[model samples]
Target: MIKVEEAIAIIEANSTKMPVELISVHKALGYVLAEKVFSPINMPPFRQSAMDGYAFIHSIKHQYDVVGISQAGDHSNIKLKPNEAIRIFTGAFVPDAADTVVMQEHVMANKDSILIATMPPKLSNVRPKGEQIGKDEVVFEAGTLITPAAIGFLASLGITEIEVYKKPKVAVLVTGNELVKPGKNLKKGKIFESNSVMLEAALQTIGIKKTKVYRVKDNLKATKQALKSILKKFDIVLISGGISVGDYDFVKEALLQNNVKELFYKINQKPGKPMFFGSKNETLVFALPGNPASSLTNFYIYVSPAVKNKMGFSEIHKPKVVRKLNAAITNNTGKTLFLKARYDETNVTVLNGQSSAMLNTFAIANSLLIVPQDVEEYKKNQLVTLLPID
Candidate 1:
């Protein structure tokens, strides 16, 4: 058995980054960059007008002649003389001779002539060339996550595609013979299979989409064969059952038979004490307990970070905070206790139906109240740390 923090550290040290691929920026959101991106051209490549105004050479005179008009996406290079101005719209290229812009609201216009009611500072409302970023400058460094705003900035720089770290290929191997697929008639002592779908959905939330699912019998031969095939192809493999030392449990033996080095077999935690972690070559494997709630709990607290780190994410852990407990609680299991709870800004309330096999209370929970192994009792309004799941 091991501590939860120790298990997380082991997984982190064993994880490695995946290979890189060149993908279109349109599809690069949530992906980490593999190479630094430099601006191909100066953003706002020309001196531009920041608003719909009159571009003119600065003068003490309160009147000017409008020589030409410049709308957005057009360059009216009409040179302005003293007291001469051009009608310029937002994002339009400003004439070279103009040194200032007077907003239309401050100007009284008569035909092509205008009277300036106010004098703005020189170069006011005129954006300088390369004001945003200069050409050949670093726009984003390696390891930056491509967010939607980053996409817009890249589009402004004319970046159609970028090199990014590839998402790891994952496989979910559910090991049990009595598991039945949904919509099937349930026989005596048989249960519906749900861990595969739940685990897959959990992976999708972290931007891992290339996942495959498989089922293996509870026997040793079937488990070994399944492990061998998945271990050979996937970067990360999640096995859903048979990790404990029950009569039909065979995941541990199968992993050893396939030459997988065990990193840790169990954690001193309630809900998921039978968890197993191992490695075969460059691939990482996690065997979560078959119970529904325990499987999901182990995935969030342990497997999610490993997968995120493999895809090049630096900050991958769930958000943790201290909140006052709404009710008193006691931990008598002599191990760490994980409970589903609801939390606001400063308080958390534990929900009912916390059994490992149940998921009803989990559906409404936004956080997990974690009680450490040594702490036996907690009074109402006592501060406890919680990991948010929503």
Candidate 2:
């Protein structure tokens, strides 16, 4: 048994970063940037109006005649003189010699001449060339995760394509002969299969779009065959349920028999101590506990970050917040525990009845309370670390 941090270090050290690929900006969302993104052209490109108003020289204070109207995407260039103003709409290019924009509401206009109600500041309400972003400037550095805001920023800089790390292919396997699919009538001593679906959704949320699921029975031969067949197809494999010491638990033995070198097994943590990690060829395999909450917790704490690291992200841990516990928690003398809890702006309350098999308690939990292995009990108002699900 190893400490949590040591196990995490092992996982991190074993992960190989994926190679970079050039992808269209439209398809680059959630992928880590492989190269610095520089602006090809200035944002706004030219001096433009920030509002619908009159563009004129502020030196000509009182009144002006509308020389022409400029709408967005206007190609005809117009020069302005003193006491001359152009009726410009938002995003229209500012004409030459026009250094100020007086909003339409501030100007009293007739057919051609306009009266300025108040004095406008020089360069007011005008978006200057390269004001937001300059040409050839680095907009994003390598290792940035391309998000919606990043896409918009790149588009603003006239960048339509970017280089990013490719998403890794993951294979998920759920093992158990007594498990039945949802929507089927439950036979005696049978339960619905859920780990694959839940893990798939969780992976999708973390930006892994390509995933394959395999269901293997309790038999050793079936498990070995399934693992062998899928090992060559995916960059990583996740096996749920057969790593424990039960009579039907053959996942560990099968991996060893098939040349999968074990990295570590039996992390010193509750709910997921039976977790196993290994590598067969170049494919990484993680065997999580069969229990729903335990499996999900392990996925968030370990597997998700590993995948993100492979995808080239430097920061992988989910954001955490410090909160005061509303209820006292008791734990065994050893084995670090992650307890499901609901936390809001004020307090974090541990949900009642946190068995490994229960998913309902996990459903309402926004965060997990981290209890060190050696701690015996926690009192109310104790400040503990909360790992958020997001």
Candidate 3:
């Protein structure tokens, strides 16, 4: 067994970036850019009107002759002479020789001319050329995640396709004969399986869509055959259960037989001590503990970060902050304990059901309270590190 930090370090050293591919900007949301994206042309592209107003050369006179009108997406060829103004709407290109714009609300319109009710400042309500962005400027750097705002911004600059790291193909294998599907009749001692659904939803939340779930019975030969087939097909395989030293625990043996080099089998942590991580060539495998809460906790602490790193994210770890504890708690084990909790900006409350198998308290938890090894008790109001869940 090893400390949690050591296990995390081992994972970090092996998580490599995936290959890049060209994808449409429309489909690039939530994906990290593999290369820098530059603006093709100057944003706004020309001096534009910021409001529905009169475009004129700034002068001492409060009145001017109305020459023509300009609306959005229309280019004006009419040039404004001295004491002349153009009726320009928002987003319309400013006519040549016009340096100021007075909003329509501030001026009184006449048949052939408009009278300005108040003297407007020079270049008021006028957007200068390249005011938002210049041509060839780096709008998004490499490793930046493309969000909805990013999508709109890139589209405005005519970005049709972008280079992004491809997401990993994954297969989830849930092993245990005692596990029955949900909505079915419960047998003697069997329980409805929740780990597969929980793990699938967790993966989908992080933009990993290439996933499939399979269930294998608790036999060594069948488990080995299934493992051998899955190893040849997927880049990452997430197996839940059969990692401990029980008679039916065969995940470790199956992995070894298929040439998966064991990186670590157990970690010094509560709820997830039997978590297993290994690799075979480019394929990564995370054999999480059978308990629902333990599997989800391990996924957040280890698997999620690894997947994000492979997708070219610069910040792969979860958001951590120092927050005040609202209540007292104690850990009896020598290993570190991750307790589920509810938190606001300044404080966190450790919820009930800290057991490895219970998911009741986890459902409402928005953060994980970190209890370091060697610390047996924590008093209320004490500051501690917390990992926020998204």
Estimate, for each residue in 60-82, the C-alpha lDDT of model 3 and write its tens digit: 99989998999998999997898
The TM-score measured for candidate 2 stands at 0.97
Which residue pairs in candidate 2 collide? none
Instruction: Give one digit per residue, the lDDT tens place, for model 2 in 1-390.
Output: 888888899899888888888889988888999888888898879999999989998884688989899999995388788989989999998987889999999889998999999877888999989998888888989989989999988877768888898888999999998899999999999999999999999999989876899999998999999988888789899999989999999999999888899999988987788999988766888999999989999998899989988999878787788998898888864889998888988789988868888989888888888998889899999988889985
lDDT of 2: 0.89
Model 1 residue 311 lDDT score:
86
After TM-score superposition, the amount by which residue 163's alpha carbon in candidate 2 deviates from its true location, in angstroms, is 1.1
Off by over 4 Å in 1: 58-62, 103-107, 116-123
Task: Give lDDT tens digits, candidate 1, residues 1-390.
Answer: 999889989999999889999999999988999899999999889999988989999978989998999999897869789979989899999988997888999999977999999889888999999999999999999888888999999999999999999988999999888999999999999999999999999998888876899998899998998888889899999999999889999999999999999999999998999999999888999999999999999998999999988888878897798999999999998898889999998899999999999999999999889999999999999999998895
**RMSD (Å) per prediction:** 2.1, 1.3, 1.3
Off by over 4 Å in 2: none
- TM-score of each candidate? 0.92, 0.97, 0.97
Minimal lDDT window, size 10, model 2: 75-84
Per-residue error for 170 in candidate 2, Å, reads: 0.6
